[model samples]
Target: MIRLDRDGPVWTLTLDRPDKANALTREMLVQIRDAAAEAEQAGLAALILTGTGKVFSSGADIDAARAGLATDGVWEEVSSRIARLPFLTVAALNGTLAGGAFGMALACDLRLAVPGASFFYPVMRLGFLPQPSDPARLAALIGPSRARMLLMAGQKIDAETALAWGLVDRIVPREALVEEARALAEAPVAAPEHIRRTIKRMIRG
Candidate 1:
């Protein structure tokens, strides 16, 4: 389940599935897409994404994926739509990130992780290629060398190492993740739509 809350100009989208380590389902994906669309419509200045429990997310449930009831296919559309939001978006990484969970985190403009959190790319064992947009974002965040190390070698980096690689902007105690994220979200930015659109066009071009 996904929880949507609006605290003044801040919008918080929580992925609530602690029982399953916050794994996302197809319905949750639709909810996420709708949430992003609604936040855009509401003109939110900032958005925060987080999950409950010890794990930020365990990625997509393989059972659901095998059953063809997962959102794996629709994720690109959802992620692209989320990236189009004018507001600054932060992914509060409350715990370890891997698989589709990592993809979701990469979708955000900024990622704030907790100290105990880590990252892993396990797709190589499955013989599947990396997610397309993810590679570019990874490269932008961690640079070319680290991106290659992560994708080619399928290495997992701890929170500290991730920080060193620039994959994560800030690291804090698990308890402080939300507060830090909210503070960042509430901070001011130039939200000029035309400028943002032009910049986005140039980036895409």
Candidate 2:
């Protein structure tokens, strides 16, 4: 279940299946991918990805993972779409982020998390490879050794550790998570689209 909401120039895509820790299914992944595309097409100035409950996402649903969802291309497609957007992208991690779900957040330009949130990707334990772009993107953010600690050793680091390791940009109180993201977006939202896009490309270079 994915909910995409538009508030002027900002678009927020929320994972709505709190009951299952917002575990992703193929259908949900498709929805997220489509929503990201729609937001970019509509010239969104900023996009935020968050969740409805204590967990941002527990990654792919267990049943779905076993059914080949873990290795699905849709995950890469979704993350790639987000990565290519000209606007600012933020992952407002509400809680733990695990498994294939790591791809989407890793693609974001910035990440903000709640103190209670944890980060890990258990591909090594689960006997599956991560999405193609995830490992490099992850290593770029947090460094190769730390990325290995999470991917190879299966270490689950808390919010503070994640911030220190560069996995997350800030640790915001849960109540203010999305608000903080919106605050970060204010400047970009007010700028011209071409100006924002130019700056983003300059940063990428």
Model 2: weakest 10-residue lDDT segment is 1-10
For residue 15, give model 1's deviation from the true position in Å.
Answer: 0.9
Please name the candidate that would achieve the greatest lDDT relative to the true structure: 2
lDDT of 2 by residue, 9-77 (tens): 998999999999999999999999999889889998899999999999999999998898988899999
lDDT of 2 at 195: 97
Model 2 per-residue lDDT at 83: 97
Lowest summed-lDDT stretch of 10 residues in model 1?
Answer: 185-194
Counting clashing residue pairs in each candidate, in order, gives 0, 0
TM-score of 1: 0.89
In candidate 2 the C-alpha lDDT for residue 125 amounts to: 91
Give candidate 2 misplaced runs (Cα > 4 Å): none
Tell me the whole-model lDDT of each prediction, alpha carbons only. 0.80, 0.94
TM-score versus the correct structure, for each prediction: 0.89, 0.99
* RMSD of candidates 1 onward, in order: 2.5, 0.6
